[model samples]
Target chain A: MAYVSEKKEKGIAVLSTATSIIVPAILGVSLIFTMGYSSGLIYIIGAPYQLMSLFEGIIAGTLVFSFAGYIIGSGKTYRLFAGLAFGVAMFFTVYYIIHSVDYVVPNGLLTVCSFIITGAFLPVSQLATVIYHGRFLRGLAVPAGISVISIIVIAELAILYEDSGQSNLAQIVTLMNSVTLVALILMLFVLISRKSSGTGRIQN
Target chain B: MGSGSLLKISVIIVVLMFIIIAFIPVASTSGVKTQGVQTVELESDSGTRTPIKHVINIYLENHSFDNLFGIYPFDSYTSNASLSANLSVPLNLLSNRTARDMLTEIPSGTFSTKDPNEGYVSYHLDFNHGKLNGFLNGSGPQGLTYYSAAQEAPQWDIAEQYGLADNFYAPCLSESAPHHLYYVAGYSPIINDYGPPPYIPYSQSIFGELSKYNISYGVYLNNTAYRCASWDFLYGHTDYSSHLQSWNSFLNETSDGTLPSVSYFFSQGTGKSMGPPNIILNGEMLLLYVIDAIEKSPIWNSTAIFITFDGFGGYYDQVVPPVMDGVQLGLRIPLMVISPYAKEDYISNTQMLVTSILGFIDYNWEMPALNKMVDDSYLPLDFFNFSDCRTPIEFSPSAGFPVPSNIHFSLVTNTSADNYSSLFPMEPQIPLDKLGYNRTGSSSVNLSSMGVGILNKDEHGYTPFFESVGFYSMLVVLEIAIAAAIITRYRRK
Candidate 1:
């Protein structure tokens, strides 16, 4: 009975690491394909071309999140934060590079920055919750679910606002990003304090 | 619930999300029909509708509006007055410097040995946020060469006889490849200077939309592969392969009265024509041949031929292109619409892009726009006047003029030639197999002749067959990875 329980624990650890890395990577790639297909379809259905940047922001966001998740899932806290920082920096770097040379979508800078901030923070917070709550897949799954729901809500709101000519999409996306960043900062503060106070530890 | 059950549920949820995200786009676009006002209509012998039966797009190589059409006598003050005599109206508006004024500022010649800087970066510097003052200063002295009206007489004669669009801009501020993609796809997903990917799936192309509606189309090229057809959607798809044909086949079909509803003709680069460092006169001759072939064909009465250049080949143009999103619209290129329904001696000022051609086709067929950019709001269809279809306009082929006989020889001898040298190094070695129709797939119907065969390698080193294989290999890897993950989880059960 003791041997069986020990093997089960090891299996859970392996599964947890694998799910944490693979799930986010899959989500990132899947979101890119989805955005590409939907943008193409929107063109076919005669939607405005300006709206494509919104989907482009989603793709960039998910890609950054996946990169951060890969590092964090390896069970290295410092490395995970470093990766997130590097990803955000690189996002801005690439945007400026493309801007200097080729044409970037108008008002794309703020939208991409917002997406990176949201994507980086949300996933890290979910990982923090997992460490504290002692739940393996639930941590990742719940956050991903919330993200999916939030994206739909944001998209719908943008469309409504655009259709009604009440506000530009870039303004809406910037506002959302601002809110997400605030929430992310608060979550990070709580997680860091808990670790410093010896109240919680990430399971390996 | 056990951890295994929880894992299974998570996987199921991810899969469900993927399916839902994927299905939404397909569901939304599946049954939607084109809506809005129809732009062009006429009472024809067959019925009361658009009299246009055939649309042919003939793509020529680089030459800007000011470079070619600046001295074409479109102004009433000029000797060749075709439009209204209004001295107050500016013949060609320039925000900072005019093309005519720039003519004296830089090298004035028929042929340029040094190519001007027309890359994406150069375009940005030259545009300068619509200040438009950087033509002579941005790219040095090479930016000021404008072809004389005498040099471009053949094209001017055609424009004067048919219709001229003085304000059409190249869709994107890039090289030939992206603009060619925009010519067919309406929107180019590729932002950089890269050539067409080896294979694009059917879902990503306007040809896919045409195939769905069973609308017959063909792409005819001299000897080179049509850049637009290089996408997997047209080449890899066995059903659409036969639609690719040679220029000769196009002529034969036109004479045989078997031309497709829509057709595209691409020039046989420098050897025959396609300008810049090569002889400009040779390109004019090729244009004359194309116009003559259509004029003598049985389908001439029902056909509308659109002739335009892909982009300004490092030449000076007076107009500053409008900015949208982050992309600055490319400089103005000459556009001529020649059809029986085309208004005589008319000059249209409708602001248009290359995608306007695609828009025109979609409007006539009642097909949905390829993308939002290809919709009526972005592209102007007012170039054609179909009010009087009873009297069909006729055109006589311009008389042949003296062309430098040894232009090809001179280019071949000059081993140290620039980028334009490779465009027409020698006469294209046309493969025999590419001359006629080679049908594939389960369908017995021979749609058209397939003329896509191996040609001289491009500068990009795109091995056609190898690239397609690489794309497929990546997809296979993705599938295997997914399968492995699932099987590993199932074994733990």
Candidate 2:
């Protein structure tokens, strides 16, 4: 019985190792493609030059979070690094995008505040990981995977709108914005509740 | 494995992934592997006999020769074969001792200044009466920055595979409008960026010349065909108007293998113009589309694609414009010749003008020179090795390799939005004071002297409201709504 249990644990470990590497790799490629298309960098289908550096930042942040998370394992240290990475990514992405289009240069305080709001999700996500254990990452990966698919669908629809000569770009953008907002909020609420309700022995 | 081993493994895997992403060969969209320039040595006798039947002139927007091809023989980008082969060196900025102080290589993909005062007066100031050192004072450091193969891989790729003319010069030392005039008629009345038509007479253009000989020709405007007023600077030419067609018509003609013998594909407006804020990627994509279309056509073998710019819009060039009839030529602009008969791995040092296209056209059709100015111009025929016809080279973008489906084969149809405004602003408020013109702020140029009543007023106002609002509103609104939703959802939970 002891030997059998040991074998099962080894299998789980191998599966977990594969999962960590493959998931982020897949997510990284999809994230780049979707974000690139949305930003008009990938598809030259009449979309103008967008904030290329900003999109690059987002992709970098995602990779850093996933890879850093895997290396540090589930702990306060991983959460801290993840949050810091997210904060930096958020700040730069906002700064570059705003800069590219000649908006009022964001003040330091505004940039800090913006990143703080966005970076708050990192800690909340870690809380969910503690509560749901190993399965939590799989659950977290679901939203990103879905988002990648959703963006591609939206892009296809945008092309249809382009072909029809009626630019519903405004509407499509609004729809995407609404969906992202709702999804983020719902995930936060679920994670926060799972933590507050004391469902599992939350590790550090 | 232990947690420590797992951590090591994760780190290794993540680093590997990033390395792969970093080294992802740009211009892989065409799916063809990057090959070195095919060193097909041109025989001395090969240059005399020519077989080029169809001439497709793609007149693009501003870029100096040095700005685009300053660092030729790009050892890093091309293959060992190209590096090992005896490549002829053209008179580039790197080779010139006079331009040594001005040889500041900007990083690849960096855009020059937006709206660099590139009118006649400013360009002359930059020219500094042929001294060529006043670029810093005239157009700022932006005029000093030049690109290598890194920023313009597709261009360099085509140049490497076929022919690049390092000494090609624009006809006029001004902005788009004047150079465009000089391109068609080999002369322009105005020297500034804009002037209302006391225009060149209609019967004087190469179009008129072609029509007179019953030779097929076309002026295909890609972006601004229908929306733009038909203010053909040609005053009273009836048949000249018939040849001016839309982008779709050009594509259809190419598709049917019925493209005109002398076809001029004009890419203008916003991103399409291959100008500032460095959107050369868009230009490259468009070039690929056009080249691919031609390759697919039945007339591919006979067609010679002369890809040249109108003027180097305030960009840095070491070469001084040569004086002809008291009008100095504009800065040296890039000219890449791509055809089956174009000499492989060749760089022509022959001094040529934008009017040289007219010269080539006239020469090819066995017609008279458009004028004395054209007659004196050196033909760009030295770039071609007509004795040996090779296969068309496939090209891909340097960065942002577009998805195959995303490559729209057709140009703009009926879209009201001018996506190419960045390439050329639709409504330029001409700096009348700088140019010494009396016309203030977007006034119509009257061409009554040439019999055309008035130049068309730009209906589309210059408001880049689409970019800022279209991009940020989506991001900001989403963030705000998410914050609100999180508050509401968290309180309920």
Question: Which candidate number has the best TM-score?
Answer: 1
Candidate 2 lDDT over B1-493, as tens digits, reads 3334433453454355446434443332122211111122322211212477789988778888887777665434344433323344566766775574555765534433454545554566687778877766555576777665555655665676677887788887776766777787777765543322234544466765665566777878865333211224454433345777877788899889888888888877535667664366566667877887787788888889999886898887887778875667888998888888776656777777776777777767766677666766667766665666666655433333321233344333232222211121111122212323211111111112123221112111111222223343334433433333332332333
- TM-score attained by model 2: 0.50
Candidate 2 per-residue lDDT over residues A85-161, each given as its tens digit: 66446445644554463331212322332322233234323322322334546555533432343334534654664
Write model 1 residue lDDT over A25-138, tens digit each, in one string: 333333222222212211111124335655566545654464345336524434434644554454455445444634422335434533543454333333423333336554
Clashes of each: 4, 8
Among residues 3 or more apart in sequence or in different chains, the pairs in candidate 1 whose N, CA or C atoms overlap within 3 Å are: A43-B371, B199-B232, B200-B232, B437-B449
Q: What share of the true interface contacts does candidate 1 keep?
A: 0.00
lDDT of 2 at B337: 85
Q: lDDT (0-100) at residue A94 of candidate 2?
A: 48
- Per-model fnat list: 0.00, 0.08
Would you estimate the TM-scores of all the predictions?
0.52, 0.50
Report every candidate's CA lDDT: 0.50, 0.53
Classified by CAPRI criteria, candidate 2 counts as incorrect
| lDDT of each residue in B117-166, candidate 1, tens digit only | 54554555566667756655444456566654345545655565566777
Top DockQ hit: 2
Alpha-carbon shift of residue B424 in model 2 (angstroms): 29
